[model samples]
Target: MARMPHTRAAAHPRYEALLAEWNELLRRCQSTAAAQEDAPDPAPYGRELLDRWGEPQRRYHTLDHLSEVLTRTTELAAYAHDPDTVALAAWFHDAVYRPDRSENEQRSADLARRALAEAGVDADRTSEVVRLVLLTVIHDPAPGDADGEVLCDADLAVLAGDPASYAAYAAAVRDEYAFVPDADFRSGRAAVLRQLLDLPHLFRTPYGQDHWERTARRNLTTELELLEA
Candidate 1:
């Protein structure tokens, strides 16, 4: 019976679905925290995050991207040590996105820390969520970091999409940085592609590596060449 935020975006079809999922995830994670008696209802927080993802300033990091990441995280849940926590991390990963900012991941992690603690989640689980959120900054989870692998692989799955889908993702990213000059955008984008390409393996999970690594590599390489050309 939590009151959803008073916002126009709350009327979107998927808003209801995501909110339900968010509430369920909070319950599941909090249950592992031993079920705090007076934990606040999580609907309001979910509404706030949905509103942020639907913000006009965002192009690529929209609600659709959030949905996709959540879906992928669920698919890769079996590989995570704490699946619910990894799913929670996916919720906050891009919750504070702004294409102009370089500290989005850190900021998002801080936000998760404050919000989860306020919602009565335990220190250890909240800390795990924060740590996973920060992992998206480089998408480089260390060896044997199961939760990190799941979250980063889910977030980066867009890179392994079909050619048309990858092209759309690239275009949407450009739209997000519409303020940057073309020359600056190209160089910056190329650097990003290079860094991702240089990773030992773009995905650490067996499922992610078997299904996505080659396609992601090809897509990133093609985009990098286009930028340099």
Candidate 2:
């Protein structure tokens, strides 16, 4: 794997901590892939993943977002049928992001499938990872899809974070779409927020429903009002 420059400094303890966790997740995923079959090493793929997450164009969907999803996955892992798979999904869900692209999720899923296969992961598990990545597009998993529910909920967990963090996230998202004209960006963003608001439940996992639903609604409502204004 090509080494990417480590731009994050130790002064940011949270970024350092998340980097550590990201490394551990990569190690665990590599080990699991190795157990499936003897093939090309997965470490390089993991490095590539980290590099992609560090892309300069990303704002809200950077390594910080990945780390948050991974953290939430850890908290909700107990409810997943295969926690490892869910974690893997979280890692690659936004791996191929592009603010102007409609195929980001599809491309990300394809990347997950190819990388997992190269890592020697079996077809079924790889397929599941792809499915989980695709689920992020609409964030609607089928009923009783425990792993899907966990991954999706974790991905959206930031929506329920504290007001300051949520504000930062919203700003970052706007920055990602900075290429768009202000009025267009506001209209598109408002549409997306309304769609989320229309959902019967913003989160699927029992843990998410119990802990995040109320706050997530409050946050979304607040953002939607601002966007509409």
Candidate 3:
């Protein structure tokens, strides 16, 4: 069957104009946020690779994840002592994510440093950004500074979110390792969940502790049960 062209010319023009306006809004936001003293100009140094593949096929750590983390980090920063550094840390935490690579954090931090240099951000601030990005490793969550703690908390905030969002996050994580066997994936994932449950508190921030600790416990318990079963 032949497809009809969009028949309402005036309506089509209006819709196209609206879409252009919406895109402009997003561009301005990214530019403004990236230009913040704390935020590195996000233009160069690694976007082409992600964009080369196009959307929908994009993996777990897309610009969407960056935006969400940034938004949460901003909120959490209010409670933090070094809000600027925390915000910068959030911007670069996942600046370089590769599911197949084990050195993602290190690589992301490198990219962040380069961006910071290009933006003329201070050397001390760049070093702090690097430290904050690496803290996401979670093998040892001993964040040396308040900014690091806030960034770490923001990154994992989804884990303590509503069950629906938590479930979605779990699925996305599993998808990140889709090549792995289901049993192996479950075992590895359950280990991480167990670690969170065993923590004195998964979140150090008072807000996180209050809002997320209980829900995170419940989710961890449930997920662990599924793994055991």
Question: Whose TM-score is greatest here?
Answer: 1
Candidate 3, residues 82-201, lDDT tens digits: the string is 676766666567655666678978987887677666655667777877888898987245644567668877887777768788788778788878888998888888888877777777
List per-prediction Cα lDDT, in the order shown.
Answer: 0.89, 0.83, 0.64
lDDT of 2 by residue, 1-229 (tens): 3556445422334655555665565456554547666556555666577778878889999887887888899999999999988988998999988999999999999998888777767788889899999999988888999999999899999999899989999999999999999999999998988888898888999889999999999999999898887
Candidate order, TM-score descending: 1, 2, 3
Pick the lDDT winner.
Answer: 1
Candidate 3, RMSD to the unseen true structure? 8.6
TM-score of each: 0.94, 0.88, 0.74
**Shift of residue 204 alpha carbon in model 3, Å:** 0.5
Candidate 1 vs candidate 2: the TM-score winner is 1
Error of 3 at 21 (Å): 17
Candidate 1 residue lDDT tens string, 158-195: 99999999999999999999999999999999999999
Clash count per candidate: 0, 0, 0
1 or 3, greater by lDDT: 1
Estimate the overall C-alpha local distance difference test score of candidate 1: 0.89
Q: In candidate 3, which residue pairs clash?
A: none
Clashing pairs in 1: none
Winner by lDDT between candidate 2 and candidate 1? 1
